[model samples]
Target: MSNLAIPKNKRVIGQRELVALTAFMMSLQALAIDAMLPALDEMARELGVAEGNQRQLVVAVFLLSSGVGALLPGSFADRFGRRSVAMFCITSYALLSLVIALIHDFTLLLVIRALQGVLSAGLMVLPATIIRDRYEGDQMARLLSLVGAVFIVVPVLAPSLGQAVLTFAGWRWIFVVLAAMAGMAGFWAWKRLPETLDPLDRQMIELPVVMRNMTHALLNRSAIGYVLGTSLLIGAVFGYVNSSQQLIGEHFGMGTWFPIVFGGTAAMMVLSNLVNSRIVERFGARRVSHTGVLAFIAVSALQVLAAFRHDGDIVYFLPLMATNLALLGFLGANFGSIAMQPFAHIAGAASSIQSFFRTFGAAVVGLFIGQSYDGTARPFAIALLICSVLALLLVLYSEKGRLFRRLNAPAKPETKPGGVY
Candidate 1:
């Protein structure tokens, strides 16, 4: 049966609307992170922070909490519905933004940011869950790539948008802008997002049942391998995000031009995803993503060599770094879709579990990378290569030493009341 064999009522919208809405929902997280880059210095200053590197904590703490937060919402979405959990997350994210804007103490701000991340974890998990509820395999990878193509726009533009706000209304207004954007996405979601979980597939909220489901998700060999692989890759990306402002705006001295340079690099992500969206259906997720992993390792090596140069020419650094990020565009959606290929019955729990590993593990790894910054790009570059190599090893394990082979398995077949499994 077609995965798209959703009931007419549940398939409430067209493909374009579904992609747009999901992308917007996911982009909120990106906006919250990337848009705050330019404001970190001022935020640190007003909050009376002394060390320059400590400013990275504002983003780091949010990411750490977000990792922990990923564990909750999916189980609820599985029990209640995707829409309700999603709306709750969006509303809370907006409110938290407002609350954080008014916070004076740095500790208080970090606490609030952590709370916001916990709630906002749904923003990351639910969209993928929602997509999984409707698609699978390479088709799923293509759709996710399309969603990523749209979602990457937030990162491309967010630093610039934040800089614009910082130029006029000050940094606090950046939170206001985030609140407004969340409100908008939430409104659209409230009105248009369908409950994708079929009633028959709904899992109970009981602890044992939830644990069993999560255990199944965790134990799946392919899923865990891909999940860990993506986590390392995601950590590498977050490492860059954690130090982007410092590296580009401060060390390389782009200063006010940081946004443009950052956005330009981010634009590579947008382009890569767009290209992946177009070709993934033909080449398969494993082939595309494995190739990307190799290229990422190669590029990271170049980045490291460039970092050691006396001049550390921005000319060489920017392109290599951008290429590495662009490679991630191919890996992210494909790895996620492949990890999710086996869990049609427990999409929500599986997504939640996978998201927890991907986000939480990445957060820890990213923190290490960020804190390792020594006013040189060497640490970040080395982290990228190490992550890519480790990711390739995990992928090899998942594929049992194979690469570029298709995952011929479909999701476990379902049995409706009148049908057989």
Candidate 2:
């Protein structure tokens, strides 16, 4: 059905429902990572992963697979239906999770984790494409922020959820829980979700066409800058995720309270996204994102300074990290919209390619920085500062040095009567 066929006032699963679903889908990514953290030591011990760094492979392998998976799912979504593609991905992911859970050999576990990542690629891109199919500008931003707000809750509770499952059962139960979640998501899509892709608008998934579309997307200077900027932003967060447990557990001596600290910081992200939902319409995405990048830079800089000054107190560190994370709520939604603004023709492929770079690039950078861990938060702090600075520069360049001015500008005139701007 054409988006126009859906009535503006039709109280169906509109933007809010779409956001809720997207949030659920995005939460899968977080759950996959955080839920495994508490189980890492046990899994390592059972599988004989040898070194601490080797244990990280379980996480890194998934991320790597996610990136590679991201590259093709968008094209598939465009050619097929969003709901169908999503169901397929989730089903595959659930099967992979089952494999990861039942396997005893370490190499098999790593291979399963990688396959799980590949399956998750569809989960990452389809929700955004579905949302993009229906909204733009402030409406899109608000929807994304709402989803972002809801998605943050996953990370906040994931570790504790994992711990609870572990306490009751065993480490393998974590994957079992993940399988249940994926199965639930698949059923949700099958039941409540409609096919968002119109048959006439569908594009074939071919290498030449994929390359051409990607090249076109890259050739657009604004899109390129935004993509790179968003990748760096994601890189910072990924680095933090990779290092957070060790930093809190080993360095801060908060092994038991690690979930509390991590969850608290994640809560800040939820709060910030809530705020972004309210203000992004008035202040504009560009303005909000620019300000957020600046705030992140300031917070990251302070973290680095504190680290050097021997004042790396948890009280100070947590607050700073929270502030930095909160800004990501703004950056994540805005950067995504900006990168996608010019590609309405191939929204699915555009979303896929954007996700590929954002997830894959961030994973690579994050893994590199995470490997440099030396039982201190300094590496994470320094990495955050560097990423923020780079993101700011890219945003500035993308906006033609008019980042603040463009953000505060009046909304573009509506193109159609009763259209949500």
Model 1, runs deviating above 4 Å:
1-11, 37-58, 101-109, 166-172, 244-258, 302-311, 373-379, 408-421
Model 2: per-residue Cα lDDT over 1-421, one tens digit each: 1252232331356566678777888888889988888899999999878898899888778877888888888877777767778888888888888888889999988887888888778888887788777666666777788987888788777888999998999899999899999888877777778776656556756677777666665556677788898888888887887788888777777789986787778787788889999998888777888888998898999999877665436876877888888889988988887777666556688888888888778877887778878877788889889998998888778777776755333233222111111
Instruction: Extract clashing residue pairs from model 2.
Output: 287-407
Q: Write the per-residue lDDT of candidate 1 for residues 234-266, one digit (tens) a residue.
A: 898878877988988888888999878987888
lDDT for 310 in candidate 2 is 53
Number of clashes recorded per candidate: 0, 1
Cα displacement (angstroms), candidate 1, residue 184, comes to: 1.7
Candidate number of the best lDDT: 1
